[model samples]
Target: MDRIEQFAPPAGTAGTTTDVGGVIERMRGFRSHWPPGDGVAVFNEVYLTVTETLGRHLSDGAFRDREAVSTLDVRFAERYLAAVDTAVSGGLPPECWRPLFQYRLHPGVRPLQFALAGINAHIGHDLALAVVDTCRTLGCAPVDLEEEFERVGDLLVMLEEQIREDLMPGPDLLQVADPLTHLAGAWSLERARDASWSAARMLWRLRGAPPLAEEFRSRMDAGAGLVGRFLLTPCR
Candidate 1:
């Protein structure tokens, strides 16, 4: 059996009320396994903040369909966790996740780069599939989950801004001439979200054709991986 398969929820299982808390705990556990300066840890910290915020919002009755949103969030998180497990067990993760795991220990990559690269892999690749997974588990269509998708996406956009503010270099040192500035500017979370939505719709439409769906997913995985690689370019 694949190493990542061990983390998969049982067939036909939906996200439970405890799933969000479980996700938070798993992310926290990564901190103990990896130092603050580790590339994977850098991204894990940023993701933990977003997950914690989402959990709070779920508790506050922020969504129209809390169950659907919660399920989507859990499904979204499981993909990254699966990839992490796969890498830890000496198995290859998806193309979109390879860059972060491979360069996780490289000293030259900055924290901000690690954060964005992980975001790129998650949003640019995993998110669309998560949407599809949620739709399947809920027995609903992608259109049915639009509200939940937007609300979750809004949280991500806010987090992306905060990540830049917190992780980016000081303005005095982040001039246009700096390669880091250009590298950071080259990717946009908003654009990634839009593209993921389009991909989700496409994947949904292609669901009946498994071969085509896999092909599209493979292409997306490779493309996101390419972007992640470029984002991780070491510029010390």
Candidate 2:
């Protein structure tokens, strides 16, 4: 998945008119196995990025004090996979099509389509905490981690924005931003982990398909901007 979405493949990818054949033949670039379609590629790629990013923090005991948060992160991964399976087995109904975006090239593009949003923000936040810990461990100041922290924050926001239309979380979706206010102070490891898990729950739950595009066709009108924007900020 990462292979496909990271950028244009060596031979480039399926263009705007890509059919299943084009997606399978042209899509390229995973560090591992290459998926067959744009849907699978993009959704899985983004998910991999998010998970690996969070995993880095989890390894540092950022989640050591919060068993529940750790559990939720694990659970969200499992559930998100299931949701994707469900969508693939039976393509989304018209009302639920927003979950897949052709241009994203990363798997798991839907914000509200799956039950994973709650953990998304939380994982990102925990990742932030890990960054804080790493910096401190390396003898860097909190101020030194500020730029890095905002990068993760921007990532969380992008995840939120991508899934926004799919889940339609009302105003509550915006609440995740509030945690940013507290980021100035290096948070307790446990607090950061819990907050991250909480926000992920909210964001991932918005993963249901809403009417948007067709199967094997480009649906993301401005996907380049969405992800380009995310990259401009930086997280992983």
Candidate 3:
């Protein structure tokens, strides 16, 4: 099955529109349904903040290509939101998302891991595909959106630092030698962002050949899933 078909969102879950405001509303809706510490909610809250900021940036003309940036941001958020919908409805989420949902409430899985696993799936897999989606929507090539991609990526990198600080448990809850710190430090958003850029370029190149593109996308999904599973490995 195709990526979207593999884990279809329930009827009526399709995004109302791709505007920045719409994206934030959809994320907020998910946040309303899931608890503050739920794996999906953890990521959604972080992403919601990012999207709201991007919306503000759009109003102020912070981007040289506002339309391109908005479209890319909206499309990227949709993929993550769809996975949230599927998980909420008891459907099997994509493998890349399975670990986050499965280990969401495990006592041994730190909040940092929950946040990073979501980042892994979204950036390592969804991002590359999102770039392709944006290219299709804009009738342009990946090269055309490279600047916007970097701008979006920079936002993510900045968010990564804040998420760690915000989600970290109190000093009383963690020891000086906590294993969770080691586990969390193992993953890097910068490395993932660089790899995603390469993956996006490759997918765009293979766009003319459906079979090759599908194969590449499948491998990328599986590879990212493995990383997510590793990131979520219990570390008390």
Candidate 4:
């Protein structure tokens, strides 16, 4: 199996609709960050935007605290929610989702069972801190039952709107519902708006120092060893 084979053939985006070549191109084309890297930048942008939107809600007593999650996180959450029905419906993707889940859970792929919003919110400081603390105790990133249950109900509601009511993708995750799940209508126009912002965010993160705080920069740049270990860390 390939590295990404863990996730199933995404439910709606497979076949001629998604164009595996296009998907590959897009994945490879993800040039959202540099000097440091794209992955960090992408996450950082989402982090900052969400934190910024949180405003007075953050502990910092000001708006746009990079460390604290914010309203933009909801936007990112919305994106994940939009893509989730497709992301999870297929048992699991043979690639990204399943492989990662199986690797973490071993003997099984329980992580794949998590809802979309669950996964989206999982990468933030709160979740990251929890895992870090847990890892410190275990002397390794403990691979246990994935934690996303708290977010499932909310995620499902958002997904229902994107699919049933609003009938649209949030704008971060690539939309697989074009001409497939949704053809011509206001959704097409909505897609254009979402895609533009998402693309811009990607570009911004890849180019240089993102909106994230200095500490996050330090953590990301800590070293490849730590990050790689993080990649393989279990989801439970």
User: TM-scores across all candidates?
Assistant: 0.92, 0.31, 0.90, 0.22
Top candidate, metric TM-score: 1
Q: Model 4, 49-68: lDDT tens per residue?
A: 33333332344443332221
Selected candidate, larger lDDT, 2 vs 3: 3
- Per-residue lDDT, model 3, residue 71, is 92
Model 4: how far residue 17 lies from native, Å: 26
- Sort all candidates by lDDT, best to worst: 1, 3, 2, 4
Q: Candidate 3 residues 7-123, lDDT tens each?
A: 333355455465888888777666665667666677777888888988998999989999999999888888887787777666877778888877777777777788889899999
Clashes of 2: 37
| Residue 32 in model 4: lDDT | 28
The stretch of ten residues in a row with the least summed lDDT in candidate 1 is 8-17
Sort by TM-score, top down from the best: 1, 3, 2, 4
Tell me the tens digit of each residue's lDDT in model 2 across 1-236: 44323432343321331122222232223323444444444445555555555555556655432333333334334333333333434434221222232233444233322223223222433343333334434455445444434444455456544544443446553354533222212223234344543433333333243232122112221331232223222111
Once superposed on the true structure, which residue ranges of model 3 sit more than 4 Å away at CA? 1-16, 170-172
Determine which window of 10 residues in candidate 2 has minimal summed lDDT: 212-221
Alpha carbon deviation, residue 46, candidate 4 (Å): 16
Candidate 1 residues 88-142, lDDT tens each?
7677999999999889878888899999999999999999999999999999999
Worst 10 residues of 3 by lDDT: 3-12
